[model samples]
Target: MPSTSQIRNDRTAVAAWTLSVSHPLMTLLVALWLLLFANLPFWRTVWQGVEGWDNGNPLFLLSLPLFALCWLYLLLSLLAWGRLTKPVLGAVLLVSAAASYFMHSYGIVIDYSMLTNVLQTDSGEAMELFSGRLVGWLLAVGVLPVLLLSRLQAPRRRWSRELRVKLVSMLLALACLVGIAMSQYQSYASLLRNHREVRLLLTPSNLLAAVHGYVRRELRAPQALQVIGGDAHRIAHVGAAIKPRLTILLVGETARAANFSLNGYARQTNPQLAKAGVISFSHVSSCGTATAVSVPCMFLEVGHDHYDESMARNREGLLDVLQRAGVKVLWRDNNSGCKGACDRVPSEDVSHLNVAALCGDGECHDEVLLSGLQDYLDRLTDDAVVVLHMKGSHGPAYFKRYPAAFARFAPVCRSSELDQCSTEAIVNAYDNSLVYTDHVLAQTVELLKRNGQRFDTAMLYVSDHGESLGEGGIYLHGLPYAMAPEEQTHIPMLLWLSPGMERHANLQAHCLEGLEDRALSHDNLFHSVLGLMAVQTAVYQPERDLFRQCLAPRQAFEGRAGASGAIN
Candidate 1:
């Protein structure tokens, strides 16, 4: 009943609606906005770098449009493939929002190492990173854009036509980007050269680069285990009784040297350790800034500069060398697994130990590592080395690490949401865990002293990495090693040697005390352990050994020993 003109207009309106539903342009715009909003920190930093620009210059004005076009070209090229557009946008929105919040909040950058650290982290440690701010940003910046993207639809076309369109569009974008770069060659070069980290700070690009690197490393066929320390044997001390030697290597977790009283901390976090005659080594640096890297590296002969995590995983470490040289090696872990360090060694995970007094909800206190200690010791037929991997000061749940009795620091941060708590409360909670570590280490020393009559005994405690207690707006660890703050790398190393063990090796504690303030690191751990247990090996470098000053090397060379051999 309508006029022809009105009917034609109605059809036109319907066609536009169909185009809106089927076309990807709307989704592309939403994606572009989401990317910019989510990565505001990156833009803010870039602006700060260029804030003192020549505002009146025509070139500067031109740069703005060029910069905008650069991002547009990138986004169009990324989203050109039709079916992946919405899902890819959703993923980008979520990941970029999360990365932006953490990168801005903690002043961090994403690279392969940081990505690996995230992938290797335990659930408990990861939980500490969650907060209300994270949830708010995710919902506001991530979810909203994702919802909008989902509601929109892509236009259906022939497969060949779609592929051709995608190829042409991407090639056009590439050409435009190249033209812009050529026009502003000097400016682009200067910006990138001066601010190399800017590349790592890009939102979804950084994430993609990191993921690609991780996947490449993971997908590579694992290399064969390169054998080292082939000429390893235990050297017999002249005219000494054939008593068993027992050394406890206590691998502490996340306890920084800055909090230890013996290391000159204002608080007496190491009250028990101060009285236990343990040599607290200050100025000790870690091999890496996280457990996944530090734990295995500490057990290898490799130094921090030459350390490769994949190599460490494939090869045998100091424990294997000790076990090869007639020493009984046992690893008791209270934290996560030994991270492949004890894969071939006899290892026991004590997380499930049901001592309610020291454990709750499947998490056991460090002292639980001491449970059934004597019984485990009795099973060893020869000189032994046992590693006690402690769950010390691991954060967000610092209060959960220790029992109530050791909660000496008052008004602790009880909640896992650390950013919501006061700095004092967080420190108090973290310090309480340190006090508890001191107790556990002291108890370990006592256990060794009790067994001193049966076997010459000693103990060495070294943390895998340090923790950051709201310092520089950083909480928890695992910033890249090069950019890591001192709090994450400066760890505490303590040594307690019984008189019998001291006499057995002719080593002096005073000599070790003198080296306390000397700069040392996880590199010292491997060779030092080899020296401590008298495990003679070709891999042993006396120059790298911390105890080299205390004991003389073997007077004569000896043949190599296998896993089943014993020194007489």
Candidate 2:
């Protein structure tokens, strides 16, 4: 029995609560909030990408926020159902917060390739990316919004009303989007066409689109493996008695050409390699800026331009072709797995060895790759190809890549938080890692020399991709190939052929040296390795072979030959 005024006050409070928590109203509010706060990175990119901002076009500028708002509202509406709105939107905000931190700080865009890199990254590499700043960003933009969202309670509505409201809201948002686009059709069309990457900079939309693409390509029903190089067979030298061949393909990670002294860098980063007389190719590019893409793409016969991750995953690549040709192939990894390149071949991973000197905390120095390697070579009784994937020059923990004894460059950045260190310190740590890689390569050469008496030996070293050390505000690699800085795409490649291998292949050291300035890329690797192994195959493209032009003549290797026997 309250008075009339008191009853009126209570009813007013209930009405206000219902209005605030109405599902459609809350969805619009959250969408607007995200448009203002969660999409700073997207707004920044748009502002910078537009030419002549001082005299900005009124319609174009008006369209920017209007389009973003309508787009976000429409996307959010799809998830604004009962009991699903808060949880799903909260997850998006958290993910968008993390994506924004990376996009703003590192100048990286969200795309399928970058998403593949993230999904393939091992625990060790992922841990290196963690920092205090990342946590702070999550707390501010991610956790706070999620907390605010958790407090909201959607007002329950009948099915008929809910459906009607959703339909009306979506139609209005769609109409607004259409209006904005039509108002500035020319400006909007030009901006989008000129800067396709801008679409990849939008916050949760880019992330969601990438996730959808990855799931469609990777998580779909498995396709049957496409077999290539079925007619592959090794051919022996005609005249001279052929000895067993041992070719080591050393794949380095994150090693750039600009830092290697052999490639004209001022520092003596390649002192050991230079003294070993390795032929360092000065001009070579990688297929991709990340290990996930580059490793698999380099192994494909299709090369980079025609490469497709799903197709590559379900196809026979270089190792499979080599194995089919009766050549014993093995892949030993110290970084991550071979990204499915070694799936069909025998492989080993030494990244978890517990050696006292070379390994600690579940990680090992690249030198651990040499352990038992010499023994394996000594036991070889047939032609074999071994790929040694080294953990070379990978950052932001570059200081940890080398042992203290090899830390020749003083004042190294010892922390994984790269932003905390000076550029000079970071370079010092990275250069020191290269020095250690040089040492490991030289030692590998010595091991091959020891086995030269029994087998013809050779080594080919090429990096999967390069790294970015605070170049143009880009700290790490994985930028899309078209927009990637030269520091991330230009990689180091070199060759070391034992005198016995030189004679067997009829390749002159002088001729190989003369071709150092020739432009090359990961595209040449497949055909070049086939040519180097003397494997005759229908898939082999002679024009793409690096050693094809250097070989003396076809007659030199056309002596009495037989089909190479498979080693079981």
> How many pairs of residues collide in each model?
1, 2
State TM-scores per candidate. Answer: 0.88, 0.93
Model 2 earns a TM-score of 0.93
Give the alpha-carbon lDDT of every model: 0.80, 0.86
- Across residues 254-327, which tens digit of lDDT does each residue of candidate 2 receive? 99999999999999998888889899998999999999889999998898899977766798999999899888
Q: Which stretches of candidate 1 lie over 4 Å from their true place?
A: 1-27, 47-76, 130-133, 158-165, 168-172, 179-195, 552-568
lDDT of 2 at 291: 92
**Clashes, model 2:** 2
Candidate 1 lDDT by residue in tens digits, 1-568? 9999999999887666543453345544654674567666566656654553553345744674455545554664565456666676677778888988777766677888789878877776677678777899889888987776676656678988866766675576567777777787777676677666677776777888898898988887988886668777777655447477899999999999999999999998988888889998899999998888899899988889888878657888888888788788999988878877888788998977899798876688999889998998877667899999999998768998898999898899888666678999999999999999999999999999888778889899999999888887677888778778899999999999989887766677788889989999999999988887878887899898888776523322221222234374
The pairs that clash in candidate 2 are 238-559, 238-560
- Poorest 10 consecutive residues by lDDT, candidate 1: 555-564
Off by over 4 Å in 2: 1-19, 554-568
